[model samples]
Target: YGIAVDSGSSGSRIQIYSWPDPSEVSKEDTSQWNSVPRVFQQEDWSYKTSPGVSTFADKPHKVWDDHYEDLIEYAEKIIPKEQWNETPIFILATAGMRLVPKKKRDTLLETICEKVGKKSEFLLENCAEQVQIIDGETEGLYGWISLNYLLGQMDDYDVSSEESNDSLRPSYGFMDMGGASTQISFVPYSREEIVKHRDDISTVYLRNVGGGVQQWDVFVSTWLGFGANEARKRYLKNLINILPELNNSNDEDDFNTKAVNDPCLPRGAKLDFLHLKHSYEIIGSGDYESCLKTTYPLLLKNLPCTETPCLFNGVHAPEIDFQRDKFVGISEYWYTANDVFHMGGEYNFLQFNEKVKSFCESDWSEIQKNSEQGAYNNVPTSILIDACFKANWVINVLHEGFNLPRVGIEEKHSTSEEADLEYKPHIPFQSAGSIKGAELSWTLGRILLYASSMIASSDKISVGIAPASKENKPFVYGGIDNPSLSSQLGHGSWSFLLLFVFLGALTLAYLYMYKRDSLKRFPTIFTQITSKLKAKYNHYRYLKLSTQEQTDLESG
Candidate 1:
């Protein structure tokens, strides 16, 4: 069992995972259980709370007092009391903490580490690394591991490859679009790609069946300003920048005073844009096609390419062979498609474009009516209003910017004999919010990796077995991963001494009782016994030497 707290931008989500300990059940059936901890899930294993950990950067102490205390307490209740000392807790902060100032972020993490280490019973030997902010690349890689593990893709380990098996069923690429940033991670097929984009690659070590190690070189990259909300902010700013040109006015005051027409929003929707305390009203034009054109450039596709192949914003990315490499998208990808359009599973560009176009072209009154009447599944008006923009943004980023082939529109560029399948009405991308009733999250990946690594490195695989069992000592309570020999010996010596004194006291009491009872029953029996003793002693005294000789013989 393990716990991971995913400190994301919006809130902290605590995920508790329990698995059959590989060390315990796996000895007899190695084939049935791999080194990968087969995590079992329950409905009540996770919880989420709001305002994010980064919000407490200024008051770091409050992070424990208000944020993590309840979470830790809940974890204590969920996990068994005996397992508390061994169950590890990891607090991994994501994009939210990355945005905080360095000093504040450090302070927040320090406070978290101090609190968790001192107050919690979790096994935390390295608090600095366990409770800390993780970079975006690691976040994406963990997400990739999570998606593939949940889908059973990582279970097929090839024995022929010692380090890694690229020939096996390839791991799916992961795409996560959060509020402040977006991440893309996958295992590149060719070694040339790995060497070419070495800086963008990170190696994740996992345990294979029979306690072998598998090292994977995953390509992970993060775009800081490409998330939906951040893209919208940039698009609004771009509109403000071009406002004066539209009015053909050279004066700054005129630009500040004028209103801007935004094509991304539905018709009749009005929003206030604040720029340096100057409020400018934006009216919707409700032009779906215009929104597509405008949002496409916001990806910054024309930025100077330092490398041969650049995706967007001067970022280098290996060419994705859509025929072989499958992809799964979460967060914004799932929400934007599932919430409004009600589309999921395989990616169908034609159907998706139609849905987005229809949703975007709808009037604000119709959209609002849909929201009020629970037509959009009770989605908030604030989020529903931007559905048009988010849909267009996802389309532009995936199809135009990332160069993901739009089914029925773009060539797949595959050389396989069955290459014709690449153009078959749908791409290899999948959008999912959860799988098998469990929330698909990177926290699961972290716990899986951690469990595998710990098992691989441990000398004693069986956890509950005492190390001192070889010495014929009884297994002590608590864990015996490391026991103090001095303490054990000290306790043993006192126990033996107490037992000796107890036996002596018992013998004296028994003798006294027997003599009293014998005297009461037959007083003459003592006289006869004494006479026999004196006769035997006299015979010994005549046959033996003095008492000093006897003492010397006894000493010798």
Candidate 2:
């Protein structure tokens, strides 16, 4: 059993997974348990609060005193008391943590660790150290892995070699929108596209039958400050600066007294606009068409893009083969479409534009009233205020921003061949927080990686198999392909320790085995060997402890 905590921008979620023990299970063994319950035996628990934990990061003391303690107390109630000691709980902060400074982040982590260490023996060993922010690429890759795995894409691992098998392989791309960043990841149509751009791939090694490893090539990219909330800021800033009416002020008095006409906002609605220490009164012109045009520049396709086919602001992304590729949009993507559009279970991409338009043109009084009926009453004013901008932003980002044609909610034709399927102008987007009763997020992918890492430890694979399990140790920051970055992030000591232990152990083993042979040549050989081993082992132990202490001090 493993516990994964996804600390998102809006809220934090806890996912519990109980899979058959890795020591006894394999790919074939999973078939026997498919009919019993949820996929891989998983359940989710979550808590919602204002402004995420990162918002209180500067006040590190507050996190454990309130938020972290409440979270753990809740876990104590739902999780079995006896199993708590053995259950490995991993807390991974996403984009929100990225907004915080490195020093503050480390300080926040230490406070979390300190609290966990004092908790009852319901958590696994080293639970405190397990809490930290995950890099954007890993978040993207894991999200991709979760989506594909849940969709039955990863299960068809046997699809190899044949060109026809490409259709059977994991093909759906993943797009996740959070508060501080957005991620895009998928497998390209061919190796040529990836070979030329090696930096984009996150190499993952999966444990196969009979102690084998399967290497998968996944292309992933993360755009920081491109999420819905952040994008709103950028969108409004650009719109204000570009429109002559908004920026016509030459004197301080004119700027303060003058009200700018803004079409994205509703008529007679007034907003206190602030950006880059500048302030203004923005009045609504209430034009949805003009709103759409204004939001297009936020995509920044106008940037000096010379290298890769960029989505926006010179970010390098592969030109998506929209006709052939399928994607699942999560986070804010699901929120706006599901909550606002009232398209809960399934919806089409084409319908998104129409519904959002109606929403944009609607009066503020009517918009607020929707929140009062049934499930709408609890909606926050801040979220409601930017409905037009956010909806328009999502639509443009999907179509004009990325050049992706409408695709959603896949409907299958019983006998249609992969190549024979028709390509319509608008494809229905299959959006849901959960698929087949199992929740969708990067938690499953973290489980996949965690499970494989355990399996790798037991398998007699190549020399590099150990690196695959490195993520299992929370202390091991960054991926193997990025050694320098990993070291800078504080995983260098592990590599040093591994080398010292390997050389020291090897020397001791050789000396013990050669004792009799050496005795014939020199009487003092054993004494000499013991002295050297003692010195080396003592030095290694001291260094290991010193490194751990230093790390603790710095983080604390």
Candidate 3:
């Protein structure tokens, strides 16, 4: 079993995962190893709480007391007490920690490691490495691995052998849109493409439990300030910049009260926009076409291309063949499509455009009326107001920015229209919050990697065992007879001798308690036990004789 805590900007979540003991079944036939051990998230084994780990920067000392204490306690309750020492807990911080100052970030993580390690029994072999902030690319790669693994698209054919058949499953592209940043990661179709984008490519070596290491070369990149919320901020700032009169007011009182006509918002919608210590009222025009035109520039497509094939902002990326390479969008992509538009799953340009167009053009009163009627039930008002803009942003990012072509619209003019294109007439993109009832999280990928690495390294196919400490060796109770347990405990050799002495003392105590009247009051429990054993031995000898011999002995 393993625990992963996803420490994000808004909140932190913890998930407990368990798999069958591979050492129990893998030794007999290694060929069936992969099929036997399936990692599963335990039922009701996930918990989430708010106000992120980064919020403790000002008071790092109060982190455990205020933030992680309850979380750790929750995990301890769910996981068996005996297995606490073996289970590994990982606290991986994402965009929230990235935004914090480096010194503060390091200090915060150090506090977490020091407190959680010393307090919690969960395995913390290398506290420094295990509890830390992960870079954007690493996060994206993890998401990619998670998506593929969950979709059952990663294990079609073994990529370990050089002479293996060419039936390996093609990995899907992954896109994650958060509030602060967005990420893209996928395995390139060709080795040439992978090599060409050497700077952007990351090789993930997955060691198969059955045998061998499967290497995956994935291209991953992250754009800061490209996420939906940040993009909206920039768009609003641009609105203020375009209208010079809005900035002309020198009086603080006047500056606090200004209004701008916003094309992106719904008609008659009003938003109290605040930027750089100034406040303004935004009046909506509800023009979807104008909004699309204006928001397209936020992608920064006009930047000078340092690399020939740039995705956006002069970043190099492999050309995506939408027909051949399928993709999945998560986070905001799922929320925007599923919540407001009521259109999730396979991306359809026509349906999406029509829905978004009507939504954006819809009057604010009408939208509110629909919400009151429970049309947008469970969807937050903040999200409802911005759904129109987010939908347009998704369209722009996919078609205008990533150049993912619209389904059946302009295939002939698509940059990916090669002469040998495998013309599959289907939308290649999918937006999903989850698949197979498991939440799509990068933490799963992290744990999977950790488990695989541990299994691959161990002679005994066990994971979650703590690494051996140089100063004080671990103590295994079962001794030499239970080699697997000893190995699992990572115990030192001296533990066996101690185990025997402990058992001997226990046996003596038991005998003394059983035959208190017959045994003499000895200084040590061992002497009393020895006397009791001798008396029992003599009685056993008398009882073993034949009936005639027994009668003759009684007469004597």
Candidate 4:
């Protein structure tokens, strides 16, 4: 069993996989290795929590209790107590962590590693070593590995020096969109460095589990602040940057009266917006042509390309071979299409543009009315109101930024060198987050690659049971044979003994909280209990006052 946590910008997801034992799977037959081990993907339990890990920065010490510790508690219960010593757990912080300052990020990492690693209920072999912030290239690489793994591209297909035609697997490109960033990864046919930015191309080499060496040369890149939500913020920020007058002038009588015209929104639209501690009223220009003109500048596609071709924002990406290479768009790509655009599954760019135009033409009042009438019941009003802008962003990003073939793999390039190129658009995108009813996410690929690398490196797998000192802790792979309880309790006594100490600390914490809560209620309870005594004291004083008044009346 293994646990993978995706600590994303907006939320965190916990996934537990019952990974197959490597010894049980056959290495000779490629078919024997299930696309995803049935037990692993099928029975996986997943849960999520709000306000991602970054939110805990102010209370840095509470980071573990807020999410990480609670998550591990659930995982400990799910796995049998005996197996707790062998389970491998890893958490990969994404863009959210990337945004944090280095000092804070380091502190957060140190806190979690020390607290969680030193005291864990399950087998978290080298916990401190395993958990950390993953870079953009690593994130993109694993996401690519995961999508291709599901697509069955990892299989070894060779027959002595022949039968190559019958033994080929379709490799895929992966595109993941999040709130704070976006990732793109693919295995290009050409080995030569194609991307203008060398950092965009990442390589991972592994020997297939079915018995042959395999190499994956993947092109992956991440654009920070280009995700759906962040892009919207940037789009607004760009308007402010270009038009300073919008910020300078506002109604003198009213503080919140700043308003500006926006081409991207529907005609007759007026809405209040907040950006960088300033406010603005964005009135809709309702001009689709002008909106496209405005959006192109926001993408900055024409930024003096250092390479032959450039995607928006001067980012150098390899040629996107939409015809031959298959791609999967995830996260916001799926959500916006499924919920806002109302295109549930697969859709072409043309269909996307059409829907975006129709939406942009609709007035805000009509959109709100539709939302109120259960047309988009589950979607929030804020999303419904800005649906048109978001849809346009997704479509434009896919089309212009990625250069996805608009209509069936551009026939004009069919006769040229580009056509003769490896990309032949056979299988387009199967836009997905799952295969065979199992959830698909980047963590799966991360775990699989890590295991594969470990397996490839070791000739004779050894579970170092000797009690490792804090300085040189033994490396423990994912779920494998663990020492007997008595053996670990005494043999690996450092961690095992520390576990009891951790439990003792927990008990003390509970007692402290109990006493504190009791003390909190004592004042209220005492106030209620002494209420009659205080009332009697007030009555005696009132009687004395009445007698004094009677004596005065007699004198009169």
Query: For model 4, how does the per-residue alpha-carbon lDDT over 1-556 read when each residue is reduced to its tens digit?
Result: 7778899888788777775555455453457432333236545478787778878766788887777877777677688889877767777788877777766775676566556665675544332335566666566776776666665666543323223443324577888888778878776644443333344444454433543444445666677777777777777767665564546665552344367778787767777778767778888866666676677655667677666557777766677666666777777776777666655345465666777787788787787777777776379976766666677777677777887767632222222211111223464643554554556688887667545533332344431111112112123233333234343233454565577578756765775777666656666765774565434433333333223321111000
TM-scores of all candidate predictions against the true structure: 0.75, 0.74, 0.75, 0.71
Report lDDT (CA) for all predictions. 0.71, 0.61, 0.70, 0.61
User: Which pairs clash in model 2?
Assistant: 84-122, 371-376, 371-377, 408-427, 408-428, 408-429, 409-428, 409-429, 409-430
Stretches of model 2 off by over 4 angstroms after superposition: 26-44, 120-129, 159-168, 208-210, 239-254, 268-271, 276-282, 344-347, 375-378, 406-429, 456-556
Kindly indicate the candidate among 2 and 3 with the higher TM-score. Answer: 3
Q: In model 3, where is the ten-residue run with the lowest total lDDT?
A: 547-556
Estimate candidate 4's RMSD in Å: 18.1
- What's the residue-level lDDT of 338 in candidate 2? 67
25: Cα error in model 4, Å: 1.9
Candidate 4: what lDDT? Answer: 0.61
Candidate maximizing lDDT: 1
Q: Model 2, residue 506: displacement in angstroms?
A: 32
